[model samples]
Target chain A: MTENSLQVSSIEFSYGRTRALNGVSLNVEAGRFVALVGANGAGKTTLFSIVTGLYAAHAGDVSIMGHNLRAETLKALGKMGVVFQRTTLDMDLTILQNLRYAAELHGLSRKDARERISEGMKLNSLSDLGKRKVAGLSGGQRRRVELCRALLHKPALLLLDEPTVGLDMSSRAGFVEHVRSLCKQYNTGVLWATHLMDEVNHDDDIYVMARGEIIAQGRVSDLLAAHSVDNVTDLYNLITEDNKNVVESGA
Target chain B: MSWLAALRCLRGVITREGLRFINQRGRFFSALVRPLVWLFIFAAGFRSVLGVSIIPPYETYVLYSEYITPGLLGMIMLFNGMQSSLSMVYDREMGSMRVLLTSPLPRWFLLFSKLLAGVVVAVIQVYVFLLVAWFWDIRPPVMGYILVVPALVLGGLMLGSLGLLLSSLVKQLENFAGVMNFVIFPMFFASSALYPLWRMLESSVVLWWICTLNPFTYVVELVRFALYGRIHWLALVVVVVCGVLFLGAAVIGYDPLRGFLARKDGGPRAG
Candidate 1:
């Protein structure tokens, strides 16, 4: 509402009788890298779905740069990029072809798409692997290709759902560094969902979610200190354990 | 999006589909072989048993193999269209379909682009089958043969739209086998594909009416008539009407809000 890159106000989403998201609200300012940390079934993926226009919220509004999700999904989505949790690359396509396809889908011209894809692949450090098919790439390489595809259009807001779930430590670090560099250099707002506390830097903004709600959100260092924990993992455990105790006591 | 942007996206989808087909060479060979087997083996076996009549669009008594070439072409398109749709379901399961669907383009245009790509592949298969039919001495009139391109394209579009409609409703690829057995077979056989509608009428007028109602029957009839340098008004009407109807249904079936294609249970889980 205040010129934030993303604003989800009291969004509610349900799958049949099970409420996946319950009156969830969050906002990400422009050019900020916000990490959403939650355990499985914490509605992290569901929240991403709503934000990317994959699923409509039952009872709330999602706006991107002051444009309503429903009213300007194409325009809003055009300015946003997403890397879904699952592998979205065509296995048979070469890395370059996949990025070119994504660029074309975003309405880039053939020449422009090719140029942008080359730049994106370079940015993701995948220029050498352009001619290689996605099926032939390693998991980490594939994830990097997905990232390059997401960045081909130079979107204002980038949403990544568990982008580094199956990577080695070095690969994970490399990916995190690339993401950090993107945020710093391009002024691109990023909403990254992950459960790995080690990926959370002390300076990064963090949102800890549980049972479809944001239980805590602030700078990682600030939240950890507020919870009297030495690190993010300790802080996460304390918050989740406390929530579980509250739920059990209520029951 | 502008029309140029839509066209670019459509071209991208078609290019991707082409690359996929090219990469799966074995599948392409097998798709071509299946129709050839029906044309050579099955038709040869039934040539004498299925007595030939002076079927219109046929000047004299033609061999069963020759008579069934266009039908077999239609069959090729039909099967390939369904196969493309089947791949779509598999892609959804594998998470690739979501990538395509979530693109910034208009959802309907994205769907239409996919349908067009399927049709392009189907047309290629049909043409290859036609080449083999010629090798077997089953050639149509030259002009009519040229016209078959557009006819096959239209038929492919109609069948591809039906495939899209089915893909949206079917949640799993395993359930699609039943569709091939029930829907595909009946649609291919009940039509004027293997036999003329008049031949079907001798068995039952009701069956004749059903064939008349079938859109595939129109496609077959259109192909049959066009192959002989003749055009059937009724067949044209059927193809145009049914093609538009099926494509409209497919577009609606994929609508973000109202369509089942965009709404399914189970969000993507981290893997």
Candidate 2:
């Protein structure tokens, strides 16, 4: 029951014949960003599903804020916020309505929910868009709304899976910066999963998955130095070798 | 979860459902229209030949509309239940079902909350139909209206649980339409909803058995008696047992939790 932001150990998950994740383990401390990079079917979403309690692991343990996800699913998941790859926001509802639903789901009091919604909206540059419909927002603004909802209850850990997949170049960078700055200020631990290399930073910790295993782990620079590669792509190429599913971003 | 948190989560689930119903104006109107057409257009003609008499709930001969009223109520809940199930499948695919699952509440309770929310929506729709049917002189004693509430609650729970089960099993939207055709239509037509079991037996003993075996028949019969200030003990038991069975299956069918643990193996894993 130690207050580790996230501690996944010896996790194994399989969907019939295909093992999605195998003996994968990682940790994130408060206020740190860790990028999980892998190709499309590399099990990033499966691992996130297991960690967020969306899917049960065949054999493993996931701890969030000292709470074991299996035995204390409610407490563990309650302490974690997630942005799934798909859009969860209602296109017809106002942003406030969407955020309020999350607030209530997390057991926030009326006053606390109100305060957080207001404060979060302002912090996320969503104050003016409170009454706006999600359908009208740009791709990036929509992602921001999802991010805002994830933060409404002030979870200890934030998990975002392929969050910037559809955004334009500038929008993608803006989202990465937005998450980094806000999550840092709140001292929230982050496990951001993506295939895009540019969305990651040299200073950030990294975990590269291939064929359901953690092929590499360390800071982006450490991974590059260890593999003797100058770039993320080259590092991925060297590590994965003939494994067809490699990192996507040329950046 | 504390009582207050649990209550708050339930309220949120119901409110979200209410909002979705309101936003879909076409669906709302279509639900109302479907029952009205079945009661007035398709059913009105078949009334003369129904030959219903001394049905336990009907001490004396009753008009076709009066005999048909409770069945229509059952039909409304049945379709509403399936509609809500369709929405669940759609939500699991493209919506915030994942977000809702992240709630710290026990997974079973969250699903029950969803079932209850769906029941609430169905009951409202049922009442609206009844109110409209009143204009056509379709109702029972003043007390009948009051007594029917609990019956509708039970009936809604049973049918909604069945729908929940279907939602979990149906992989794609295409399969759901088949369920509606195979499950819903057969359950409605083969049961005592449109006609009595005796009439079905008179026509075909095999059809009668099929009607007797359908859980929806018990649901309809339960509503039939309860609407008239009585309870059919057999129907009551069958409905209760079927409700429990369907809900249990649905909770297990849901993949978010230990549902997968039920299987030994076999299904392609997708990212």
Candidate 3:
């Protein structure tokens, strides 16, 4: 089996005449946190979609846990769990029902699902809220439930797309800490897509995207040293500025 | 996937649909109300103008209400079928469809499970309509009531499959309402649902040909024969075949390689 949890080779995708992804490549290894940082339209969601098998890339290969997505799609997909940027919970169903449905979708038996749901609730401190409908939950609470649903199947590679968009500062911190702990506890590889600089932890790997291309990627300390910057914020601004200058000069 | 896992997935989907159906009272009522309005108001007005000769299944003359009741049952399934598809479009826009598609099960099985869930809801609405029509003095024979179960299921599956096909083709929610109008109106009007095929032929040869070609006609006829405790084998064959074909097309339309819904380019990416 491969060491990396996910390996996306140089992949390109286009919509009609305009390109959505331009030869992007990235990887997430076991027990590591990889932050994909990009402004809007930086192709974060598109890349996530490609990895999750929602859209096939026009060019390139994506493998999850050593299984090729195209040839062994079921096996490849079975190795991962995803929480999309948008809320996917059924608003009409209770929180427990939503989690159970997700477990069943992953082909977990009833007994296994019950055990996992309970274990997940305890892990996230989400007990006692199980009976509430998702429609009634606050934005942050709903986001936590989504996270719980994703973990019920205990997937090796967890893909989360902007999972903390509407969360408050304290809630955001809590969510981040919770995910970090889970990654370490299970040795699960995580690909977290976000635009918020605060969510990227120290020592984490970073991929900076602009206009659908991955402009820079490396460990945070290495990226800072390479860019002659002291912090990720300054390094990010410098990289975007450099790209802007090159674009302006070329045009 | 193992057989047990596939069955579990199917059960999850079906149970969710069932819960939604029970929770939404307005949706349940609306599914029945449309057919009831046609059965009571429209059929009453048309009764004086339309006289029925004793057909093979009929020992004596039948009133317009009695004749159109089976058709109204088909109408219930037809509208509910489209409603399920409309929800599918909404689901795609809201990102739940992505969750559904990402499941490890085969794409065809996932889609077919969804279609079957819709059919199950439609079948329930159909039986409720028959019960109401029964109270209105339009009851079928006792044996006929038992026989119509399979007919209504087949009709529901057929209409729901068409809904799946339409949902895959209609790209946006704003565009789906117009497409539904185009599809549902023509299907109801051109079929033998509202009037007999002979009546359609008397109006125009072209109209008759269209009514004959419409798959909804077979669905209505299949239900009608079952209500009279008989079988229309040709109509049965046509309905089943069209159901399978539409479902097949739907599965293809959802394929990630070249599916209409799978076109991520040019469209704003939904989270």
Candidate 4:
């Protein structure tokens, strides 16, 4: 509604009888980095899936850059890139080949794809490992390669689903920094899904989801302040605690 | 929509499949071995027991192994196609399929590209097996050798589409072995894969009708007819019809909404 980078209005999804996303709605402005923090099964991945055209939402609408997701999936997807929660890289392929494959899927020429891949690798500090098989790369390095692959086609909106799931402290910090730098440098709207509180910067917009709903949404510091919490972890705990209590009390 | 884009996607799919095949050396060897075992040991045992009838497609008396080579080729494609689809189900379970399915390319094209990639691999394996057949002095006509490429491609697509159809319907990898045992083997055997249709007719009219009805039989017959320097229109029609039907079923099976395969419980919820 805001002509923002992305808009999800009243989306509902279910896995059989279990409702995964219930009336979920959110908006992300152009070039803004929005952190979606939630507990496991809190519908963050479900939301990401809908936005990326991986799954269709049953009860609402999603738009990317003014294109309706249902009506113009390819057009919307052309303007977006997603790094799934799992490693999608061909483990047998070299990092270069994987990136090239992604680029080709997006319709780039081989020579052009090669150049863009190199640029992407350089952006992610993975230029040195282009020729290495993904199977041999460290978890963090594989994550970076996945990120590089997502960015190969210069997508306007980049959706990363738990990009730092299994990384060490240093690697997580390094990866987050690279992500922030990419968003800033390229003016790419980013919706980063993560359960880790430490990854949410104070200035960034935050959406705290629990029980298939967004319970809190604002700048990280503002939401934390409004909730009278010291940090994201405490705020998350408070929201999830309230959810659990509601469930127990049948409210 | 552009041809260039489609071509690029096609290349990507083929390269990915090729890389996967190269990485799994043991699988390649085993795929080769399954067909060879039938060609050498099983065929040798049955060669004397089975009397040869002069079928229209056969110019002279052919050994059991020679007669079944095309069928074995179909089996190789059949198995390999299923293997590729099995990997796709694994990819879905492991979350890799989400990446491919979410790409900007149309889902149907993406799926067809994957099928084509399987076809390419199946054709390669068939050629390798043919070379070995040649070494054993089992040669189809030279022109038939060339004709086998397109025949193999059609057969590969038909089998590969069945694989995709299975992948879409079967959510878990564990269920696939059951499919192989119940569906694949029965389909292969019930058809004329091991013997000629006339041979089947002598045994039972019902069995002959079943073989005629079975699409796999047509694929095998098509390959067999081509191998012997003859063209079978009925077989070709059946193969083409089955291929299109299976591929259509696969597409419907994978539809985002209203597809039983797309329905799943638990795991990371996508939308």
> Model 4: per-residue lDDT, tens digit, A21-133?
88988888877899998888788988887777766788899988888989988888888888888788878789988888888889999888988987888888888888899
Q: Which stretches of candidate 1 lie over 4 Å from their true place?
A: B261-263, B269-271
TM-scores of all candidate predictions against the true structure: 0.95, 0.94, 0.97, 0.96
Which scores greater on TM-score, model 2 or model 4? 4
Assign candidate 2 its CAPRI class: medium
Best by DockQ: 4
- Interface RMSD score of candidate 4: 2.2
The TM-score that candidate 1 achieves is 0.95
- Model 3 chain B worst lDDT window (10 residues): B262-271
* 3 versus 4: better lDDT goes to: 3
Model 2 lDDT per residue over B1-271, tens place: 6989888888888888888788888887888898899889766887786657887988899877778788888988899889988888877777577888788888778888888898898888888898999898886777988888888888898899999999888877777999989888888888888888888898899999999999989988988898889999999999889999999988888755567322424221333
Task: Give me candidate 3's TM-score against the actual structure.
Answer: 0.97
Off by over 4 Å in 3: B264-271
User: Which residue pairs does candidate 1 place in steric collision?
Assistant: none
After superposition, which runs of candidate 4 have C-alpha atoms over 4 Å from their true positions? A1-3, A242-250
lDDT of 3 by residue, B75-174 (tens): 8889988999999999888878888899999998998888889888888888888888888899789999889889888888888889988988988889
What CAPRI-style quality would you assign to candidate 4? medium
Tell me what fraction of the real C-alpha contacts between chains A and B each candidate also makes: 0.45, 0.58, 0.56, 0.70
The model with the greatest TM-score is 3
Q: Per-residue lDDT for A119-221 in model 1, tens only?
A: 8888888889889999999989998898888888888888999988888999998888889898778788888899998988888888888988888888888
Candidate 4, number of clashes? 0
